[model samples]
Target chain A: MIDKPFNNKAWLFVLPVFFLVAISAIIPLMTVVNYSIQDTFGNNQYFYVGTEWYTEVLGSSRFHDALGRNLLFSGIILLIEIPLGIFIALSMPRKGFWVPVCLILMALPLLIPWNVVGTIWQVFGRADIGLLGRVLTGLGVDYNYATNWLDAWITIIVMDVWHWTSLVVLLCYSGLVAIPEAYYQAARIDGASKWKVFRYIQLPKMQRVLLIAVLLRFMDSFMIYTEPFVLTGGGPGNSTTFLSIDLVNMAIGQFDLGPAAAMSIIYFLIILLLSWVFYTVMSNFGADAPNKEVG
Target chain B: MAQISLDKLAHSYVAKPQTDADFALKQIDYVWQDGGAYALLGPSGCGKTTLLNIISGLLTPSKGHIRFDDDDVTLRSPEQRNIAQVFQFPVIYDTMTVEQNLAFPLVNRGVARSEIDRRVADMLDTLDLKDKARQRARGLSADEKQKISLGRGLVRYDVNAILFDEPLTVIDPHMKWQLRTKLKQLHEQFGHTMIYVTHDQTEALTFADKVVVMYEGEVVQIGTPEELFDEPAHTFVGYFIGSPGMNVLPCEVDKNIVHMAGAKFTLNKGYADLVGKLEIGIRPEFIDVKSAAEANGAGVAIQVTAVENIGRHKIVRGTVNGYAIDVLTDEDQSIPSDAYAVFNTSRFNVYQNSHLVRAHS
Candidate 1:
């Protein structure tokens, strides 16, 4: 098909957005790209270091450990949150006075700032003065998030789940309510069991929204930083050191700008590639499957 | 398969209905025979859907009972009632193929795999969906999706009655006739007790053995389409049923004579002691336009206003003593400026307060 000729005047409407994106994204990205390819010293002197920082970051055991931990954490959170959110949303009342009440309660966790959430969990997991730690310790369990690597990981994961699961619940709830009442009535008249109704009717209707929820949760969990940083501080022997935490420690703490910049680009590319894969696979699912004749 | 009956059935959305207007469906008592096709005909918000929902056991009536055969199923759930309902909008399992959607009801009821396959295959052919049988229901057009919905209702052989609440409302005008004909064919072949609800008179007249005409939450009359058109029980029915509906004009009843628009006509039955607002109703087809001299003693004089030729016939509209009157005539029949409108006395119906007046003992 022949393409329509472009209008030069259409560029005027897009110039503001292009300028905003350049200032907000491309300029910072180019700075990262520039740093990734060069080495800088204290006297405003620099040396071109091509592919060295990239190779160093790629071969580092620290990066590998952090990447593995990040993947594991995101996977675990998704496994817990998606189903739990759906369950909570399904159990919620479909209408009347309780709807607003339930919605407000579900939105409470999301309204809390990320660092405040981390700080709250940090204190809450302390065995010395925190209520949860005191109760667990009182229950005769050895629990201390400050010094124990496994305990620190557990606390951070729990904190992440508590902070973000509501987002999934809200999205799923909107999807559930959007379904017309006729579907349920039809299912009932058709003699469909509760499980069949949920599996076939409700789930399919909620697919689009669930796709959005899954994508948002995946991206957010993959790049999770503030909460874990505050709660675990990449401490308890690096057990809770996720990818973002390691990047921040390298770039900010140790001032290893070259390796950190290379790692940042790699991180961005990984997120972009994974998101594309997720979008394509999910959108193609149950869409235009080859027609097979029955009988 | 089953005779459905509603006994003094009434429903209201409000918890405590204090007035008759509060009831979505006023008291209704009727029985639909087994293996009969009936239509609940009414304008929107006339309780046609409310009555359908009540019969399908989707909504529990605030008062009275519903029975299938000899069993009182008023409190039973929809599944327990064994009823099928096709909504105005098509409802199908979007993720499933056409075959799967048709088989859903049978699968839910735990029918044998062979039986489900056979029924699904049959429904696919019957709905003319054999070519699209394997396609996902989400990809089908509105009419095709609706056909799938209808197939789901028909796939279950054990259903007591199939209730349709304007099932063809969303179908295209051209496809509507085809689906309606298919529905009639299915009803005749299967001998199922089908109650189709619609506001369209043509649909009601064509698909139903009996049309129950409802007005403002109450059933005005229940009869064959011919009976409803010929003898409307209430003035609302006269106004609602026919195109260019019956003209109901204010009149004065005196002994055996009815005086209307400064003209006098004799009644077949006398109502000497009738004490209410009197009116006479006649269909436009029963009125003839004649010259003033020829209709001197037989008709009332009218000032002609407009004549509309509607392909098959012409509708002559005029004023009889400042009241609008319509007369349906052959297309070749020419109207005059000052014409006398003559009523067929045999087809004349008198109403006392919006209800037909029948002679008493």
Candidate 2:
């Protein structure tokens, strides 16, 4: 074993980051912890009620419904966005004058603010004045997002796909371009089919970038609030309410600070746990495989 | 297997090449015999790689007809041409095991499963990778990864030719020799036409049956290693082939007599009215160094500068009348403080405008 030099002064350099994180993250988290374990009445009078809010929040069927909705939304968006992004990236021009044009077009949707995207889709999907709504109506289809929970879910899902698949495309594109030209030349010499080339070369090369894209899309979709709140306002009957939306409704809408605080902690832990699982599984992918035929 | 021929091959990166300067590879016609080993040897930016790429069907020549035996394959793709190429760096499918990588080409061509397994196993034994056959290719060292690349190419039995583009550049020195020998043995066993490209003279001389030397986007000479050493078609070949290379000195030729740097000598063969930048080329091994008095006014006086003792021989570095010259002698041979250098007439060559001039016997 190599001997490492010991230095107490190293901690001094870490002090700045430690203080910044405490102020920005730790302090707020501690306040939430404090609120979750106490009961607050009018004029800031409080009484200790340890673990009561946690039990109440965990046991509620409404919280379970919101959690289910959040997982379902995140799952649906991930399934649609990941493969769609890779397909679009593959179809994009790899060379010539059209490359920059295609890149700028892909980046356009990502530049729009989430609230703006939600508002635009809200107006665009209206039955009377919106083009999409009128087109569906002209086609003799019953379409109304304001009254139907399915319509609200479809509108929000489509809007999110439009605004976010481009990010995945950009990430995958960068990964694809970074591969050396030699690999392609060798593949051609080997008489590999287009699909085999993608399977053996392109997909493996893009694994790291795809991991980042999946995690980002999962976390963002799970914590979705601004866009859906603007578009469906947690739906006609909580059909589109996610964890963050539910947490906001519980804390600010109903002023149930204790229960909301408990729910927030659980939400943070879920995101953290899921991201860690994703990172571990994705990074270990193909690193260790059974000694079997590649096919 | 089929013999390959290039008819007036040339290439230019420019869309419309206006002049010869625009061409990266000048027009040339040559034939590589079936199952022959040929090396494209040259310095960097000399179009050797470009020529190899053209032959491998990775790049199409601007003006050329490439024929395998009789069929013109000029515009054919690499796959259509049935070619295999090992690149400078290892290009292995990271997800596949060593055996899978070796079997990939055979599988793609729809070879029988038993045949693929047999060939892959044979290749694994040949490459000394049998122990790692089931391990992922991504975890191998650079040289081992390169071996997999070679195995992939060699596993296929029906490829027209195997092209190697400095495939040993990434290998360590000790391993380079071993791999080179392994490649030569494989060539002999398989008898597949191979074209190896390298800038190193040792690699070219050792690997190829015929070495095609290129300079400034043009092939200057194509000959066996001994022929390249004995009779260089151009001055660049003589300068490029040897350890210290050949020493070229400006000389005036008249009939059979040659006037050198402040000295004169008679030649056995006569040259007929040679003109335009005449010089005499002689390898360092052919030059003799002796004491000035023993020369008896037959040789030119040279100022001995430095002597390097290389285990088997000593190289005498000096200048004769402001022209640099090198002489090779036995290590035990004592260099006289005042040295006189004589060129062996039988081994000397005459060059006019950098091209060798034929002698009138």
Candidate 3:
């Protein structure tokens, strides 16, 4: 073990970042807590409401719809990305000059700002000018994402999958490469079929990275606001109004600060609770995950 | 339980060899008798492991025909070949218990439960892994993991042969000696056709009945350990099979006497055909050492470079007849700065153009 007297010195190193987080995060959190308990009238008049808005938000139908929609979106995103990413990763050649080229292409969308992706897709889906809409209309299919709830949901899910599945593919590919060739040779000598080799050897070896892919995809999809906000604008009658977008609408558009603050607290708690559940399930069921693949 | 025959087996990693310079494994022919313990011994990248993988059906020979017990298996997969292989590193399943790992192949083949249990139990007892049978293999030490791998290889009685690719490499030195002994005993008990591949001469010599010495891409010699040490067929074999290796010196043969460094050494026999391009080889153990000049004491004078006391013997590293040589003597033997080194002519061998010309004078 390292001697602790390396000492209060390491604490000094972390002090700057800690202060920055405290100012930007902790101060606003304290303000939210204050709002949770108190209400104000027109001219800075204050009256203690003490959890009334919290109970109200908890019972609100709009809050329930946002929460459910958020969950459905996260579930759909994870379902689409994990297997599709693994398939792409498996189909790729193990070694070649094309490997780095393929990797850079996969990473292009990830490096772009999320808002820019939204802009690109928004213009790309315009029926009058964009290619996708032009192609679909040219094919004699009636498609309007802005006017139909089904089209809006399908478009949002597709955008999320295209934007995020590469992350999963890259992680799973790294995990697969970490497996030693000796293991594959042993499997071959054992007379294992191709399916068995994949099920028993490759899948178990990739469990740890698969866990990271699952959690990351879940959290990002649940809190997704920018792309759907720009593309569908939570339109076609609230079909794509995930919790993150609903929270913004309540806090800024409607200017209902107290209720939105309560909703924000609830949203943070829900993300925390769901993430904890994912962690517990993965640790218990997939406890034999290959953590030493890095080495 | 089966004889394995490889007929005209050849492999080239490239499309074509330009001037016969690039074949990884040249065309070769050999047969392994059933229930024989054989070893393919060679240094690294000599195609020994590649040949082992091919025979195990992990790699199909680019051009060849393979037969197991008179049945053509050249186009078969590893499953159809009925061969088990143990690798250099431990390859047992980490998630399974030792018993479970040994029983995996048997269960996959739909063997009855009772037979699987009986076989697994027997293997556990044979490997001395009964205590670890219930424990997860992931937590076991490297040696223990290797024991599990060996047990898995031996679990099925229907396998035609068992191939080992330097399986004791990860084992500790002290355990390596013990494991090699255990493997030899297992072969004797089961009467299984076994082929082990290793670069270590001691491991090959002490454990195998027949040793195949390979160099570059071809088997240079195949004989019993005694034959390999007593008469190495190739120069590479002569150097690769012994710890200190054989000492080779360029010499000119005059009748029965070989002349070099302005000195003449008499041989036990005469070889008139080997007059030019002659090289003489002497085992380090067979080189006679002396100190004084009298009678037959006029030995080859050598510049003694260093004398090393290695437990039971003193290895005298020096230059004799302008050629580097090492002569082993008793620990108490005093090697002078300039000493007399003489190889017993009866123990000498003469080579012409890298092939043995005469074994006796």
Best by lDDT: 2
Cα lDDT for residue A39, model 3?
78
Against the native complex, each candidate's DockQ, computed on alpha carbons, is 0.54, 0.48, 0.35
Candidate 2 local lDDT, A140-218, one digit each (tens): 9899998899999999999999999999999999989988888999999888999999999999999999999999999
Error of 2 at A256 (Å): 1.9
Q: What would the TM-scores of all predictions be? A: 0.95, 0.94, 0.91
lDDT tens per residue, model 1, B65-115: 999999999999999998888999999998888888998888888899998
The residue-by-residue lDDT of candidate 1 on A126-184, one tens digit each, is 89999999999999999988788888888888998898899999999999999999999
Candidate 2 regions exceeding 4 Å error are: A1-4, A289-295, B294-296, B304-317, B327-337
Candidate with the larger DockQ of 1 and 3: 1
How does candidate 3 score on lDDT?
0.83
lDDT of 3 by residue, A91-115 (tens): 7777989899989988887888888
lDDT (tens digit, per residue) of candidate 2 on B47-78: 99999999989999999899988989999999
CA error at residue A127 for candidate 1, angstroms: 1.4
Candidate scoring better on TM-score of 1 and 3: 1
Candidate 1 chain A: worst 10 consecutive residues by lDDT? A286-295
For each candidate, the alpha-carbon lDDT, in order, equals 0.89, 0.92, 0.83
